[model samples]
Target: MSTTTEARSGFSPRVALQKVGTSLSNMVMPNIPALIAWGIITAFFIEDGFTPVPALGGFEDAAGNPHLGIVDPTIHYLLPLLIANTGGRMIYEARGAVVGVVATMGVIAGSDELVTMLNLTQPSDEQIGQIHMFIGAMIMAPLAAWLMKKLDQLWQERIPAGFEMLVNLFSAGIFSFLMALIGFYGLAPIVNGLMNLLGAGVEGLISLGLLPLVSLLIEPAKVFFLNNAINHGVLTPLGLTEASQNGKSVLFLLEANPGPGFGILLAYSFFGRGAARASAPGAALIQFVGGIHEIYFPYVLMKPALILAAVGGGMTGVFLNVLFDTGLRAPAAPGSIIAIFGNATTDSYLGIALAVIGATVVSFLIAALLLRIGKQEEGDIAAATAKMEEMKGKKSSVAGALTGAGAGAAGAASAADDSGHTGRIEKIVFACDAGMGSSAMGATVLRKKVRAAGFDDVEVTNKAISSLSDEWDVVVTQKELTDRARQRTGSAVQVSVDQFMNSPRYDEVVELVQQRNDPEAAEEGTGSEAAASTAAGAGVGVGTGAGAEPSADEGPGSATAPEILSPESIVLAGSATDSASGIDEAGALLVAAGAVDEGYVEAMHDREATVSTFMGNGLAIPHGTNEAKSSITRSAMSFVRYPEDIDWNGNPTRFVIGIAGVGDEHLELLQKVAMAFSDPAQVERLEQATTTDEIRAILGDEKESDA
Candidate 1:
């Protein structure tokens, strides 16, 4: 575990495998609808199907002339090409997909040629059949796409501007041609041999009665979001081949069996506690009836021990299938019972039904026992869901079902409803004249919030207004410069703010990014409660007027208090002529404490010049320019209360909290300060509190004096 942690911080072998499986699954998951269509067509039109159409099924027509049916061509060409294109896009987007398709065409042709050559050279009772090249497409597509990506990167910005189209077109074309040759001569034969090996291995597993053990792998992998990779990437192609020879193959039922998930959900409904118990019945409905196996993953994740149930159920299902000798005519996507029966062989209905029932019962019994043993340990459904998504690197579509109403508004209010931008916000930029002062500070603050919300992929950067590009998803700027920033880029959501530090709008921006990444989280009001609680512990929203007053037992002199905000740093009574003077006074306190240099005061004024430090709720946080970090440096904060409301820009400020943050060391403390003052009631209590100790208690944590 330590080695895994050192290998990749926050990622283990399980997560690494999940990522690989997800990537492979992504190539085929999108094309399941097409697979379903082909399956439906095959189930009805094949010669052995219920309503056999000779011409459509590729059988000899009434005139005895052979016809190429839709089924054979669809399987031989369409499906493989679709998989190749999808795989290519995964590597390098549309261009990669185009190259991938072109390369795969060569593999398909080479496979046919290989079969023709074999049939002629070794003509015997058993003629060599055409290899479908599904695996070949999966291999060649990504490889061709990756090569294209690397080739493009080499000439990326080096391409002479005006001739970019000409260079891109011809380069891709030439690269595609070369890749096709490689796929034909190099990849096709290798992939054919690999597929033959894999097929033989499966046959061997079946004959040896070891096939049921596959459930041991599939069940756990599914919980980690690798279900699609196993079911589609590995099983679907093999099943297609098997179905072509035999009327149906049991391979399709292996991973797509819904019994295990249903059983686990049923167990949760009976034995689980809290949100898991409440949401289980509904989740079971979605899992068993709706065919979304992902809905039950959180239940297993919330209690990893419950995986035994899934394994038990899955093994039971497989064993039953093997015992009954039942199979499906085509893949049953979503693993829904309806789809299962719909694709079942003419004689497989009873056996498949029994398999599902037996699997469910076994899983339920095992899961119920596990849940009963740990009945007191309530599952943190939201946390597990977040972990699952972290492992998946994206939100699951049906995972919301498990969270249900237990999901809270940990995230700030909905910003998409009012932010005026509906599109997804992936990249955010803070723009100012030089991008050195207020803009950089603002970006740092928002970036922290975004990270706290678990949006590691969303990029936040500070850029000079002149350097602003069209690719940004959200552009944050001071109201004074928003117009200038807008003129440079017309599409990005424009967020105007009055302050660089502790602005309410920052919360809105964080919420907006959160919504775009995880709509369910936003809808459920999910944010980082743990981070918030940590911040709260550091002191936030604990004021008397805020409805909570610390007892005499817990005051400023308490031993557990953070030392950053000590008695010397807090002034109960402070005075300033105006906002400018107040900011100077605040910076002077930091300078006096040796927390910053004299130059930091000037940067504070410069930052103020771009945007006011006056945040809402009668509070203002004056801070130096983002470029002035070198001026001096211990992380420190000072609290000054003005008895008279000082005129800050236009908003009356009763509290002026000065900050000199060193890197992100002061961010958690800053969050504490923001949360405390953001509330009007808390601000009111803060304004009325006469003692510095009283203010400390209200904010949350007490301050510890220097030893």
Candidate 2:
């Protein structure tokens, strides 16, 4: 099966449905509070007799011609639109409130033009109100967005964990105060000035005429990125106003635009000869009738320069609307030929036809130019495609292995016998720097070799080297982790696999395992048993009946052994050490080990000048991960001491600087290092050690301590 099909198959239908439901809910949910606020306002207007249409449905007498009623019709028609526009803007433009709020206000004013056309309210007064609302909205949206972000950050950090719900409730209260501030102090003057300015034609030109100019000036490559920002940042918020004005929620505009289907069609069009020729026909059908503008997005994205052309076309269309003094009463819904009829003037058809023709021409010309200038190489495309496919395959294989392992574990548990014993072998864990790539492959090969040699009692697993310890019966790893693994597992056998550095020999490994498990079977009816016994009688320790010196080079006393230290001794020792020098020394050691870069030591020293690195206890793990220019492979430890007192975490530190070289793979080591420090006996010995050699001896000790 193709990779795409496999990826799709991995996601359950229920999960896909849940994602859809969540997206829909998020888009619509913000309007609920706005609806409640508007409802209260509407009810107040009705009771005050300011409403033109009564709540219970009755027009007041013309003789009484209530002033309240005159204002009521305008309020009733415009308030809902204002709330929706504001709320919708908030939802879509999550990060930038200023743009969203202004766009929403614009949407409300734009949509209110529809009410004027319908004769629900007088045009002059409504137009003035529209201008006021637009200006007010523009100012408030950004302020609200900023306030929301600040409150969110404050709640996440300062509030206690369990009081999250209370914090959310408090945020709402704060938002209400902000809203009130805007209504009383912020909105009034801005609205009044905007109404006055909008009276002149300059406002129209500034708002609409500049669009085409801006589009032309922007670099073609950057236009689509800007377009995405504008749609989410500006247009979505505008939809809110439409929803609020008509008492019809238009939140779906945020989701429906620039449809995914169009993108798919455009991508296929690049390879499909027939599809490219029919592109305009398909776009016209979907965009004009179905009102799906996204049907063209794929085409635009395929050649990004076309996006600039589209922007140019859009700006031109907006400018023409201004020139013709045209206004949309409602947001042009189902954005197509038929929908335009609802809002179109005598010049509307001509405006739209010009927009489509101009946009198409720009897009086509730019695409053709780009294609002609730089045709893609077939070899490069094929290579990239192959690499992508390989990565996809590896991911699939790993996922399948994990799934199979989980299922096997479950089955084993369920199939236990009456003796409460399942026929499952114990897991043998092998670890290194990064878990489960090379190590995992090695484990698989080792497991096969072991099983073939009839050692089926164990099942092999691989993990990060840092996790190797008492977790497994026998820990297997490369030479680098030999010292660390031995420190963690005192008596537990550790097999350092040289096969990692060299090519693996499966047959030799199988034979070795067999020999280790059954010495008597191999020695049967042979004089070699006598020779082995003779060797054993000698002062030599044999591994697999092979005569070899246990201490090959050094004397028995020279073997590194573990040391136990008391917590009090550790503290006292640390008190005598110079803390600053200790940290510097530790940094220097790491640099020498090639685990960290040189300047890193200096940076750490500089950081230390400002604050102490001693987190707590007698432990001072001083290190720098960011100093290295390239990726780190393993962590390195450096032991240091001061002859005199040094201030640690408010305590005098004598023994200091436990450097940990942390890389992507070495995180596990940090945990083990932490465990080592936790032991009071180890801490005492670490502090008491006078020389670097003494410290290394104590650390290298494999024996268990009673402290």
Candidate 3:
């Protein structure tokens, strides 16, 4: 939510960028359906030649030849209505929707209305009033919605019970009518004038050989998750106009080019690691053939500077469009090469291909340089393959490829985590960016799995990320949008997965739920030989290997040991009854006491599962792996003392001290801790201490001897 408490905390460049990017993405998300649907209609319903299908009441032309007969109203009516509804819905719900349509109609009104209403004659010399289509709808819809929203606020909760229906109906109708009048009389001329000015500026920029400069903003916007917004809300309308006038418009080629993404994935093929390498070819097939350009977004996000590759790629595509006059007749829904070629003009196909190739090559080279592909080692290849296996079925393909590959080093495969645990799970919800298309499909796949596993009592539903709640047992979202889901549901466990359609993790989730209904199952299944013990170092300050200081010299702050732990940081607890609750409490306590970042808790659990933190002598030290260093705000230690030992991965641990060390910065602390806990009797003495001063006396003695 706030770039992870483990990441930059406050006003940093990184956090600032996230806010800006998220804000832009939200603005255009709701309107995406209208944009894509309109583009689809234009792409297929319209004609390329006169000798088109004659199925719909085709009439012979002056030459007595059959031609296309069906009327295509995509641009004239459907697009304006769809855009108007989208804009209105952005401000309010159904009321805003009605106002938006009415306002759009109002904006398109002209003096010709007088001719119909009052029988006035129109002057032949005067040009008919031209309706502002896309731009006008966008403006008027929001304006109308705002006015309606204000009216609704006035009617807030005061209406009599029986009069509620009457008031609601009348309020919406009157507000819509009033807003429509405002749109016609006040906003129309001003909005239309601004639209024309913008059009002129764009046209001038294109003619002056500055069109490629557009990518500077467009590419960044795309990275901000506004690719859909820019493509649909702004560019598609402009392209529609150009297509009407010139049969095709280069404007469509600017943001919708798949070349840059294609190029990045191609580079990953050569330079990327395990999952990344294995997933690249499949992603390429989907990106190029299936037209889902979203598959490549995660790759770019891995390195934000990689956006330059997109900019360079987009600019090159636009450059070729200018040089060769290439443009598609409609927006490319999937932004795939196949779609682009399908929608392009016959004469421009070769030019479009060349432009795409140029973008791909340029981006690939840039991405390769950025990735430093040659540096990856062969040992990681097997690990990556295993991660890829976690993603099962077409969910990987249907959702987007390259998800598991990018998080190659995450290493989520842990005995404790991979194995099911005992926890009640009544609800399972699949979430996504929009939480409709992909998530719904994912929920269906998971639901089938749940049923097949004979767990039909479990509820599985899909909803948008914004609608996610803490009441749900497990909330799953796509890898890229996991932060958004986390922000919404802090208490609920959030699963970061690549695809919603299908994943091997679904079975694990179901198994966990089953184990929850029968907690004994988890214990029975997990019964195994005691894990290989760590060094059974003696009491708090008794015996230690005389040569142990050599290993200490190689630890944190090597060649320089510093006093890192303090008595004031320790907290003595009566006992820990439950391992699960205790671990969570310990992690949260560290965060609350300002000892570590919020992300450290999750990372520490991950690290604990990967490698047992139990260091014997009734002690278990939990610390995140070096990879989790970013989650550490500063180097600090949190000591939670349990009088009665608790089960720590089957080992009894009396102390669960969490260390938030930056990389290997906690070496000095570890050495001091080792010396303090060296004697078995010293640990016993400290455990019996009732106060901080008493505990300090024991530690103080060890410090005195070390000095």
Q: Best-fitting candidate, measured by TM-score?
A: 1
TM-score-best of 1 and 3: 1
**Preferred candidate (lDDT higher): 2 or 3:** 3
lDDT of 2 by residue, 448-504 (tens): 445534456556667766545442444566545556665654323355554331223
Against the true structure, whose lDDT is highest?
Answer: 1
Query: Which segments of candidate 1 are over 4 A away from where they belong?
Result: 2-11, 60-66, 121-123, 156-162, 372-380, 405-707
For candidate 1, the 10 contiguous residues with the lowest summed lDDT are: 405-414
Q: List the residue pairs that clash in candidate 1.
A: none
Q: Could you tally the backbone clashes for each prediction?
A: 0, 26, 16
TM-score of 2: 0.32
lDDT at position 588, candidate 2:
59
TM-score each candidate.
0.60, 0.32, 0.49
Per-prediction CA RMSD (Å):
15.8, 23.4, 19.6
TM-score order, best first, reads: 1, 3, 2
Residue-wise C-alpha lDDT for candidate 1, range 459-545, written one tens digit per residue: 888877876744466788877788787676554556777766566677677666655455555667544633442233233432222
